[model samples]
Structures are given as C-alpha cells and as structure tokens.
Target: MFYDKVFFLGKILLHLSIIYFMIASNKIIYDRNNYSDKELISLYKKLVKPRLIEEKMLILLRQGKISKWFSGIGQEAIAVGVCNALSTDEYILPMHRNLGIFTSRNIPLHKLFAQWQGKKSGFTNGRDRSFHFGSQEFKIIGMISHLGPQLGVANGIALGNLLKNNNQVTTVFSGDGATSEGDFHEALNVAAVWNLPVLFCVENNGYGLSTPSSEQFKCKNIADKGVGYGMESYIIDGNNILEVHSKVLEIAQSVRVNPRPVLIEFKTFRMRGHEEASGNKYVPHNILELWALKDPIENYQNFLRKENILSEELEVLIKEEIVHEINEHLRIAFAEEEISSTTENEIAGVYKHIHFIEKKPNQNTTEARLVDAISNGLDKSLEVFDNLIVMGQDIAEYGGVFKVTEGFLKKYGKDRIRNTPICESSIIEAAYGLSINGFKSVVELQFSDFITSGFNPVINLLAKSFYRWNQPADIVLRMPCGAGVGAGPFHSQTNEAWFTKTPGLKVVYPAFPYDAKGLLATSIEDENPVLFFEHKALYRSIYQEIPEDYYTIPLGKAKLLNEGMDLTIIAYGLAVHWVLDEFKKHQFSADIIDLRTLQPLDVATIYKSVKKTGKVLIVQEDTLFGGIASDISALISENCFEYLDAPIKRIGSIETPIPFAKNLENLYLQNDMIIKEVNILLKY
Candidate 1:
C-alpha cells in the first residue's frame, strides 16, 4: 500500500513537470505594440488604399468592364503587412486572392487593368487571367490557380536562392483551405528538413469557400501545425495592420539572416465572397456581420485616427491621388491593342524548326541493339552541346545504374554533371530553374514509375511555362520506361500516356541509336521542354553505325525503318525493337514507322504510311485502354479511312497492374507473340 502511494506521487510529479514546460513554451514572447506611431499609420494607409482599389476593381468586374476579380476585402492586413515586411529582392508566390500584395509590390496599375480586360498589355501578355500575373524582373513567381501547389515551388525557389548564397527570402501565401492538400504537407516537410529561407503565410479567414475552419482542422490553431515540423510559428491578429506588419517583418528578417523557414498564421476574415460573382448565401449572416465589424482597413484607419497619426486632410488627399492614378492607368490600358500578330508569330516561332547543322551519316551499316544505340547516342551528345547538364540520382559519379551516362562526369566536371538527391520533385524543379536560367538541363528519372513524384514540377510548371508566362523552359526529362527487365511494378512502368494528355509538352521515344542521337540533339537545340522516354530494354540495343559528329533529327517526324507494300507496323521505343525482331524472325517485310515525337505527333507520316499499306498495326508497351496504341489506331481509322484495305489492329499490355514475376511481367508487356497478331491482318 505504501509503494503504490509513492508511485502515484511520482506520476503526479511527472505530470506537473510536463504542464509547467508547456505553459512556459506557449507564452507569447513578442508583442506588436512596440512599433512607432508613424510606422503604424503608414502601414494602415498602405493596406487601406489597396483594399479600396480591390473594391473598385470588383465593381468594374460586376459592370462587365473586367472579366473577373479575386478580392482580398477582409484579409487586407495580411497582404499589406507581408509585403511591407519583405525586401525588394525577396520573392513572393501569391495565390489568387492576394491582389493587395501584388499592388504593394509595384505591379503597374495599367498592367493590372489590362490583365482584367484580357488585353495584350496585361502582365502575362493576355495568356493568363488577371490573377496569375508574374514578372521575372520584379521577382514575383506568379499566382498558381491550383490550391497549395505553389508551396512546393516556393520551397524550390528558396532552395535555388540558398544554393547561390543569395540573402533573399521566399514568401508563399495560401488560404486555410490549402493546408489540406498533400502538396502543402510535402512542401512543409521538405522546407523544415532543409531549413529553406521561406515564409509560409496562412491567411486563416475563418472559411475555405463554404467550409468553416472548425470542420476542416482538429488542431486548436493552424500555427500549431508548424510545431510538428520543428518550425517557429506564431498566431497574429490578422485584422490588426500594425500587429501583422510588426510580426511579419520580425520573421522575415530572421529568415533572411539565419535562413530558416517560419509559419505565420493570420487569424483574419474574408470580407467579400470568394470571387466577384460568388454569392454569400452559404455564409451565415450573423457571422459575416460579426467579422465585418473587424474589417482590416476600417479598423486600421480608426487606430490611426485614435493615435492622432492620420489627419482628415491627408487621408482625403491620399484617396484622391489613388483614384487619379488608377483612372490614368485604366485609360492607358484601354487604349493598348491586343497582342500583335508579329508577337504571336515570334512566340510560335519558338516551336518552329530551326536548321541544325547536319553531320555525315553513320558509316557502319550493321544493325545494333536498342541499348547500345542510346548509350552511344548519349556518349556523342555529351561532346556536342556545350551547355548540356546531365543530372539525376546516381547518374554522375556512379555513371548511372544502367551506365547510359558512363564516364560523363569524368569527361565533364561536377557542375555540368550533377548527382541529385533522391527527391524527384526537387530534381525536376532544380532542372526547370537551371533551364530557365540559360542552361540546358537534362534530368534523368531512374525509372518511369518514379515520375509521379515529379509530376507537379513537370506537368504544371515546366510544361506550361511557355504557354502561361511566355518563359521558355528548355528541359529534357529522360525516363527509362517499359517492363521487360523483370524489375517489379515499382521500377518498370510505361507511363508516357499520362504525359501525352497534357498540352505544351513534347514527348519523344527513339528506337535506334541513330534516331536516339538525332532526336536527343534536336531536343537539346529546341527552345521548348521535351520528355525523352528511353526504354530500359533498348538501352544496350545496338543499331547501324551512327555518325560520330553532332547532328539533329527533326521533331514531329517519323522514320520508316523498313518498307513493305502489304501492311504497316506503327511503333516507337521498345515496340519498334519488338516489331523489327519479329520481322527478322518471320521474314515478314512489313513497313515500320518510328514515331520520334508524340506531342507534336507525326500524323502526316502515319496517314501516308497507312494510305499505302492498307493494313495497319499499332503496338505499345502501355496498357490497352487509353494507351498510345489506342490513340494511334483511332487516328489512323479516322484520317486514313478510305485508303484502308483492312481494319486497324492495336496490341498493348493487358489492363492490369504490372506484376513483379518475370512471367507475369512478360505476359503484361507487348512482346513477340503480340507482334504475331499482325499476321492475321496480313492474311486479310
């Protein structure tokens, strides 16, 4: 009985210690009331002018003079406060609702007006809508429409700045709703791990569209989320302009000097509907009124008046000046013309064929395997391009697991030949950064299956960089695809079809060493982004002797590997290899066409080939449904209908997950047996 009593006392003591520590750590150490009277009033005036401008823009949008407007009515303090805190050199990744922040950053008022009007004078040259404005010269990375995706990009930008030893900070603004996305969590984890110079600002405006914060999160406050990542975080009165500015500046300064990421939660409210046309029926009337009383602009104005910092004459003069400035810019924007035809032609010319110096053809006429062709092609490419950077996991010093980039690091120093961390997203983001900054970054993903991790950077950012912002991102993504190597489901995947659906990206799969060398050289010289899908099984596949000198194969052009009168076999990458092998074994002299690029598809070649042969066979290593084979067959059936002698045939992997066993894997991918299916068509 005495021992039990002692144990209970010990437990009580331990509990007391934990409670004491929590109380000590949770105490607020910084206060916002320490700012000078003039500074506080200046911050208040800055936030108020932007909020009024947003209101006027919304009015214009409602009047149909503007297309759309994302207002930051209730959350003005957060935007103004953060912008005031950041230096001119620091970068900002603002979301759609941060118009106040954009204005504060000195984005021209006429550019904003032109953006709303969808004019060529707009920030994005009329490519994107009003909310997505960005300027490289201004260091604004642009707004991302998809919720929470910019967090990872912000981290990536910070990483680049850090690598260059630049004392610049990156601030990413997101709403309460964005915290739920997987990207947000992933980015936060990565930022914490690396301690990047980033500021994650969460504008907790009570509701994420219709859902309240209470239903979406179980934590007491969003700032608590930062603690899990071992980051310093704070909850500030977001409606209080002075408080927001003081806290943000403090954190921004700390981040710039020490280079550590911090999470700042602004407990604010949305004064307007989510968008200009959005209705407030879902919002509770009482709650709206309750939050409206704490309007950032009005509250800050009242604070300034009470402190005797803002005079009535000065406030009126400031309002008049803002109105006149806005009107002048609007008039200028209206007078500006739409994007000129010459500008369009210039942008279109970016994708046009520029002549590449042609070299002598390969002297050796002996047929080689696919792998040997790719290896030889890469070996030659390294010597061709002076700006080419080969980077991937274990691709440099290790010479790659497949030895495709063997001796590359020895030939080129570490700067040109880089080995990246296993983080696929970082690898792709870094490549995009390097490419945009004038280096031709050739990024290699060990297997196509791992491309999922880098999909955001590749598909959303790199692929659309040209279309969205008129910025050329010349990057080559090399993925070793297909499933014939007995490497399980994790390592072997033919996932090019997923990327094919996305626009503004070029996809290529070369079948022979000569073709590989030519296509790779073309991709390097092109100003657009390209995904070079190299089949693992074909890495060592030798082909007829390729030229030793530098040369380029035309993009969106197909080559006829073999010519025959009866039927045509349409294939690319490993499928081309399979078809050639079948032809040799069966003595079938069928016409074979290799689709060098997928996005700018060589439809002209396919149409001509099918028109002549009458019978067509489409084959690929991907699954049957929604595969590249299916797409090719549909195109052939639709375009070359009158010329067909027999119905188009398509052979692909069965519609199931790729298995680990060699037999199952073989059964899954298109093989010699599948190629034999063409014999039935040949009989017709």
Candidate 2:
C-alpha cells in the first residue's frame, strides 16, 4: 500500500514536471544580432496578428461559427522561424498547430476564414474544415489530421528536386508526439538513405493530446534520434524566433546546396490545450501560469520594446490594424456562399471522368511469362514517358524479390529504377510526391499483405488525391497478392475488396498475361491511382502469347474465356485459372468471365452472362465475408434477378487466418470448394 502510494505520487510529479519543465527556461534572445532591431520589431508585430486571430477564432467557436480551432499559441515562434528560413518555392507540410506557417506564407486571411466557415471559396471547398487545406500553387500541403505521413511526403518532394538537380529543399513540421509514429522513422530513414534535401522540424510541446512526453517517448530529445538515421541533428529554444530563424537558415542554405536531411527539435510548450475541443484541464494551474509568464509573443514584444523599436502608439496602431483586417476577412467569409452536398445533382456525381484512350493495337502476339510481360510493359512506359519511374525494396540491382523488375537497374539506372528503404508508407507517399510533381510512379509492395503497414497513405493520400483535387495521382501500386504456395498469413493474402470498396481508387487484377501487360500499360498512362494486384501464383506459373507492341485492355471490361448456356463462373486473378481448370476436369459447360478490374466493375458483363446462363457462381481467393464475391452477388441479384434460375452462389476462402500448415491452408483456400459451389449452382 505504501509502494502504491509512492508510485501514484511519482506519476503525479511526472505530469507536473512535464507541464512545468517544458517552459521552465526563460532564454529568449540567442543570436539576436542576426536580425536588425527594425526587422525584429516587424516580425513581432506580424507574430501578434496570428495570436490575435487565434483569440478571435476561439470567440467565433463559442459563437458556433467555426467548427474547430487548433491554437498554436506559444509554439508560434517555431512555425514563423522555420517558414521564414524556407524559400518561397520550398514545400511545407504543416500539422494543425502550425498556423503561423500559413500566415507567414501570406495566404489570404479571407480564404482561410472562408474555409473555417465552410464556404465554396475555401481551400478545400468545404470538403473539410480546420487545417485540411493546401495551396498547390503556393507549395503548401494542408495538414491532414494524421501528422507522420506528411514527413514522407516531404521526403518525396525533396527526392523529386534531387532527381532534377534543382537547388530546392522541403521543410515539414510536426509536434513531438508525431516522432513516435512509424512513418516518422520510415520517412527519416528514406531521407538519410537518399541524402534528400529535407528539413524535419519537430515542435516539442511536451504533450500528445493529454499524454505527457515522459510517457510518450523514451528519449531525451527527439533530435537525438536523427543521429541514428545519419542525419544532422540540433535542439534549440523554440520560443526564441531569432535563434530558430538564424539556425534554420544556416542549415537550409547548406541542405539546398549539398542535399541532405536535417532534424531540428524545438523545445517549446503549447500554452493552450490541443484544440478548442480539449478544454485546458489536463495542465496544472501553476504550470499554466509559469508558461503564461514565458509567452512567446509577449516575450518578443518586451524585447522589441526594450530595443526602442516599438512605441506605445505604434503597438496600439498595429493591434488595431490586425484586428480590423481579421474582422473584414471574417465578414467577407460569412457572406460567401455556403458549400453544400445535399443537392441531388451534386450527390449523384462525385468521382471525376474515367475513360481509356482508345487506340487501335496491332494483333502482334509474343509468348512471354507474366513477370517478363510486366517488365516489358514498364520498359515500354519508361521508353515512351520520361517521367515514369518504378520504386520498391530490392527493385534496382536485386531486380525485385520475384525478379519482376529484372534488368531494370542496368537499363534505366538508379534515378529511374529507384531503390528505396524498407519504409512502406513512405514508398507510397513518395509516389504521391512524384505524381504531384508531374511524374508517374509504379510502386511494388513486395507482398500484398505488407500493404496493411502502409494503409494510411494508400487510403488517405492515394485514394483521396483524385477526389480532393481533380488532379489524379498518376501512380500504380503493384501488389503481389494471393496465397497458393506456403508463404504464411503475413506474406500471402488476397486484398482486392479492401481497395475496391474504397471510392476514389481503381483496382485491376488481370488473370491472363495478355490482360496483365495491357492493363498495366494503361494504368501507368491513366489519370487515376490504380491498385494493380499481381497474383503471386500466376507470375511464373502461367505463360501465354501477349502483344509485343504497346497495347491497353479497357479497365472496366471483362474477358469471356469460355461460353456456355448452363451456368456462369465469374472470377479474377488466379481464381480465373483455377475455375477454368476445374471446369476442364469436371467437363462442365459454363460461361467463364474474368473481371480484369474489380472497381468500376464490369457489372454489365456479369449481368449479361447471368442472363444468358440463368445461373451464377462467383469465385474469389479473398475471405468469404465482405469479399468481392459479396458485391458481385448483390449486383447479380439487383440487376438480373428475373433471369436467375437459381439463388446466386459464391465461393471464397474460409473465414479464418491463413494457416502455415499445408492442409489448413488448402482447406482455407481451395478450388475444390469453388467446384462444389459451382456444381450446386448448376443443379439449382
């Protein structure tokens, strides 16, 4: 009981220290000689504007005008200092608390206010409020709620600049809490490996939401971890704007020329709560008072006054001017048209145009393995489009894990056939960076199941790219999927429904070498993010004569491999081949349909086949519940219900984890199960 009391007291003391120690130091002017007194005064006045605006936003929040408000109260110095050091063209991916960075970039206050008001003129056009907005023209990526992925995005932009030999750098900002994320380590590792020009700034506000740094990280300083990644690391007083600006500028200049990543940890405190929603309750009263005394804006204001740069009259005038400007912007924002999606016409159409560039192809066929055909398709794309690139682990010299990208390194060199660190999220986020910068990227996820590790980028960034902006991320994520051989649960899994269910993503799973080569060729050129799932079992197992010349099979079109009036067997990937073999064995007369792409599904072809056969059996290698088969079954029921002679039958892997044992694995994913289902459907 005594030990428990001591432990509880220790926990309380730890929390108290986190709040108090974060702002215990009063060091303000370190390297004040860099900025002139006049410039310092001007910077202080500019800083005051954001603080005042924040206060105004809080009032608006109370008035039910603004949906949310994330205050950067005491941490303004970090954003102002870092953004000041960056060039106009340099990219900045800021988190919610870095409002000063947006203000520093001179983004119109009216536009920002409109975004808060959910107006049509807003940055995200009312698609999102808060900080979920960015300016492509200004090179400022808006803060997504998740912070870690942006660092990888910054690394990608830096890589693009490096590839072009352009003397530009990218500065990405996150809080100390973000350092614990896998994406942070992944992004830093990639930046270090490539020697990309990226400045990663972490504002150590001592807490992640309500959790203190003592509990959040097991390190002394976030910057110290950068040393492990072979990056230049530094820690400084984040409250001192002059010190931050000078140090960041020095490193920024060196990085712009030499090209290397630098990690800077700014020791600061968040004076306010995490956001408006989180009331100031977690912090102890005494600690809040201590931090209030060390307020960044107030400290800087005192320094400016001491230097005789700011007078009483001037201070008053500046405050009045800033307040008036913000009020005007708010007034304009409130009067602007409110963005609404409730209208029938608007709700009916959300996705952009999707069409294949129709060009007649020569019927020249050449026998090739699926892997070789994919390589050929990539080679042709690289030859035709200079901006096209293939990136993944062991893709360069080792020629990928399955030898899919064999001879690519020798043919294209390191710049084109880029080798990456084993950072899955960064791999896809880097693809996003390249796509936004007018480059097409084909990323190979070593195995399909590994995509789970990088699901954030795939779902949030890649999938949302087209829907957010009409700009399609011209990226193809090549996932080597499916379980046939004994590569257990971690390595082998079919994940089609995961992507197909997602709205803005296109999923293509070709069954034949002909479709594999053609669909891949088109996916590279198409203006949409495509998840090209290459069946691991079929890469070397299947061989066919494919078109030697460049060709593209239309995406949303199914191929009829066999025709029969008795029943329809619809499948994709290796399932198509399995169903065909089973039919041959059983001597079953059935119409076989291979769905080349899962999303933007060829429902018309399925309806046609179901109508002709009067019976349908959907087969998939994915798990039974919530699989692609369920959707196909529903489509058949909805569209061709009258033509059905039997209730729709569907076969999929058993609803359980894929086992390492051969027997259990076979039982989990068996073609015999599908054959039995087909037999039942035929008899019905």
The residue-by-residue lDDT of candidate 1 on 424-530, one tens digit each, is 77667656655543466788888888989888877877777777777677788888887777888788888889888876788998877778877877787776788
What's the CA RMSD for each of the models?
A: 8.5, 4.6
Deviating ranges (above 4 Å) for candidate 2:
1-25, 34-38, 342-355, 469-471, 586-589
Among all windows of ten consecutive residues in candidate 1, which has the lowest summed lDDT?
A: 23-32
Off by over 4 Å in 1: 1-45, 125-127, 276-290, 333-443, 453-457, 488-490, 521-525, 540-552, 607-615, 634-643, 660-663, 673-683
- The C-alpha TM-scores of every prediction are 0.82, 0.93
